[model samples]
Target: MRDAYHEELDALTDRLVEMTRLVRSAISRATTALLDSDLQLAESVISHDEEVDRIFAEIEASIFDLMARQQPVAVDLRTIVVALRMGTDLERMGDLAEHVAKVARLRHPDSAIPPEIRSTILEMGQIAERLITKTGSCIASRDVESALELEADDDAMDRLHRRLFKILMADDWKYGVEPAIDVTLIGRYYERYADHAVRVAQDVVYLVTGSRTQDADLR
Candidate 1:
C-alpha cells in the first residue's frame, strides 16, 4: 500500500510536468501567432485551451483523491498541496497565452504589435518562454537554486513591461489610443505569464525544502 501511494504521488508529479510542458508550448505559439498575424495558428491556440482546462480538472481531482486516501505526511503532503497550486498556475499561464492568441485572431492579418516596438514585444515573449520552461525543470527536479533563479528571470519581464509603458507614455507616440491599449494589454499578458511561472517555481522550492519560497534561498 505504501508503494502504491508513492506511485500515485509520482504520477501526480508527472502530470504537473506534462501540464507545464504544454503551457510552454502554448505561450510560444501564441507569441508567434501574435507577431506573425497568423490567424489559423491563433485560432488553434484558442481552441486548444480546452485541453489545458481539462488537464487542470484532472489534476485537481487527483489531488483530492490522494489526500483522502493516502493522508500524505511531511514532504509528501507539501508536494500534493503545492502541486494543486502549481497546476492552477500552469492553467492560468495557458489562459494568458490564449488571451494573446485571441488578440491576434481579433486583429487577423494585421499584426497586433506595431513595427516601432515589435522587437520589445518579441523579447518579452522570449523571456516568457524561458521563464516557463525553467519553471518546469524546477518543479520536476525540486531544484531550489533554479527556482530562486526565476525571480531574476521575472525581473527581465518586468523591465520589458516598463519599457512598454515608457513607449506608450512618450510624447511622439502616433499609434493612437486603440493601439496603445493593445500594446498595454499584450505587455500585461506576458508579464503576468512570467509572474505565474515564477510562482510555480517558488512553490517547487517550498515543496522540496519545507520552507516558504522566500526563506528557501537563505540556505
Candidate 2:
C-alpha cells in the first residue's frame, strides 16, 4: 500500500510536468498567431486551454485523495503542497496564453502589435517560453539550483515589458488609442505569464529543499 501511495505522488509530479508542456505550447502558438495574425492558430490556442484545465483538476483531486488516505509528513507533505501551488500557477499561465490568443482573434487580420513594438513583444514571448521550459525541467528533476534560474529569465521579460510601454508612450506613436490599448493588454499578459512561470519554478525549489526564499520575494 505504501508503494502505491508513492506511485501516486510520482504521478502528481508527472501531471505537473505535462501541464508545463501544454502551457509552453500554448504560449508559443499564441505568440506566432499574434505575429502572423493567424486566426486559426489563435482559435486553436484558445480552445485547447480546456485540456490544461482538465489536467490541473486531476492534480488537485489526486492531492486531496492522498491527503485523505494517508498522513503526509516531511517531504511528502512538501510534495503535496508544492504540487498544489505549482498546479495553480501553471493553470494561470494557460489562461494568460489564452488571453493573448483572444487578443489575436479580436484583431483578426490586423496585428495588434505595431511595427515599432513588434520586436519587443516577440522577445517577451521568447523569454516566456524559455522560463516555462526551465520550469518543466525543474519540476521533473527536482533540481533546486536549476529552478532558481527562472528568476533571471523572468527579469528579462520584465525588462521587455517596460520597453514596450516606452515605445507606446513615445511622441511619434501614431497608432491611435485602440491599438495602444491592445498592446498594453498584450504586454501585460506576457508579463503575468512569465511571473507565473517563475512561481512554478519557485515551487520546485520548495518541493526539493522545503525553502521558500525565492517564492517570498515573488509575492
Candidate 3:
C-alpha cells in the first residue's frame, strides 16, 4: 500500500512536468506564429491548449484524491500542495500562449508587430522560451538554483515589454491605434506568460527549500 501511495505522489510530479513541456511548446510555436503571421501555426497552438488543460485537470483530481484517501504528511503534503500550485500556473501559461496565438490570427498575413518593434517582440519571445525551458528543467530536477535563475530571464522579458511601449509611444510612431493596441496586448501576453513561469519556478523553490522567495510571497 505504501509503495502504491508513493507511486501516486511520483505520478503527480510527472504530470506537472508534462504540463511544463506542453506549455513550453505552445509558447514557442505561438511566438513563431506571431512573428511570421502564420495562421495555421497560431490555430494549432490555440487548439492544442486543450491538452494542457486536460493534464492540469488530472493533476487536480489526483491531488484531491491523495488528500482524501492517503492523508499525506510532511514532504508528501508539500508535494501535493506545491503540485497544485504549479499546475495552476502552468495552465495559465498555456492560456497566455493561446492568447498570443489569437492575436496573430487576428492580424492574419500582416504581422501584429510593427517593423520598429518586431525585433523587440522577437527577443521577448526568445526570453519567454528560454524561461519556460528552464522552468521545465527545474520541475523535473527539483533544482532550486536553476528555478531561481528564471527571475533574471523574466527581468529580460519585462525590459522588452517596456521597450514595446516606448516604441508605440515614440513621436515617429505611425502604425496608428489598432496596431498599437495589438502590440500592447501581445506584449502583455508575453509578459504575463513569463510571470507565470516565474511563479512555477518559485513553487519549485518552495517545494525544495520550504521557503518562499519575495516574489512568491507577493503571489
Candidate 4:
C-alpha cells in the first residue's frame, strides 16, 4: 500500500509539472502573437485556455483523492497542499495569457503599443516566462534555493514594470487616454503574472524548507 501511495504521489507531481509547462507555453505564445501581430496565434492561445482550465480541475481532483486515500502527514501533506496552490497559480497565469491574447486580437492589424514601448513589453513578457519556468523547476526538484532565486528574479521584473510606467506617464499628455489605459492594463497583467509565479515559488519554498517566506504584495 505504501508503494502504491508513493507511486500515486509521484504521478501527481508529474501532472503538476506538465500543467506548468502548458501555462509557460501559453504565456510565451501569447507574447509572440503580440509581438508579431499574429491574430491566428493569438486566437490559438485563447482557445488553449480551456485546456489549462481542464488540467487545473484534474489536478484538484487528484489532490483531493490523495488526501482522502493516503491521508498524507507532515512533509507529504505539505507537498500535496503546495501542489494544489501551485495548480491554482498556474491556472491564473493561463488566464492572464489569454487576456493578453485578447488584447492582441483587439489590436489586430495595428499593434496596441507604440514601437518604442513594444520592446519593453516584450522584455516583461520574457521575464514572466522565465519566472514561470523557474517555478516549475523548483517544484519538480523541490529545491528551496531555486525557489528563493525565482523570488529574486521577481524584483527585476518589478523594476522593469515600474520603469515602463515612468515612460508611459512621462509623455502621457501627448497620447490619448485610450492608449494610456491600454498600456496601464498591460503592465498590470504582466506584473500580476509575475506575482503569481512568485507565489508559486514561495509555496515551493514552504514545501521544501517548511517555512513560509514573506507573502508577495500583488498590488
Question: How well is each residue in 1-219 modelled by candidate 3, as lDDT tens digits?
Answer: 569999998888888888988998999999899989999999999999999999999999989999999999999998899899999999999999999999999999898878898789889888988988898889889998888788788888888998899999999999899999999999999999999998888888888888864455424
TM-score of predicted structure 1: 0.95
lDDT of 3: 0.89
lDDT of 4 by residue, 67-174 (tens): 998899988887888888889988999999999888888989877777767888899899988998988898799887777787667888889889878887785546
* Tens-digit lDDT string for candidate 1 (146-174): 88888777888899899999999999999
Candidate 1's displacement at residue 100, Å, is: 0.5
Model 1 is weakest, by summed lDDT over 10 consecutive residues, at 210-219
Residue 199 miss distance in model 4 (angstroms): 0.8
lDDT value for candidate 4? 0.84
User: Which portions of model 3 show Cα errors greater than 4 Å?
Assistant: 213-219
CA-lDDT, candidates in order: 0.88, 0.90, 0.89, 0.84
TM for every model, in the order presented, reads 0.95, 0.96, 0.95, 0.92
lDDT of 4 at 127: 93
Model 2 bad stretches (over 4 Å): 214-219
Clashing pairs in 1: none
* All candidates in order of TM-score, best leading: 2, 3, 1, 4
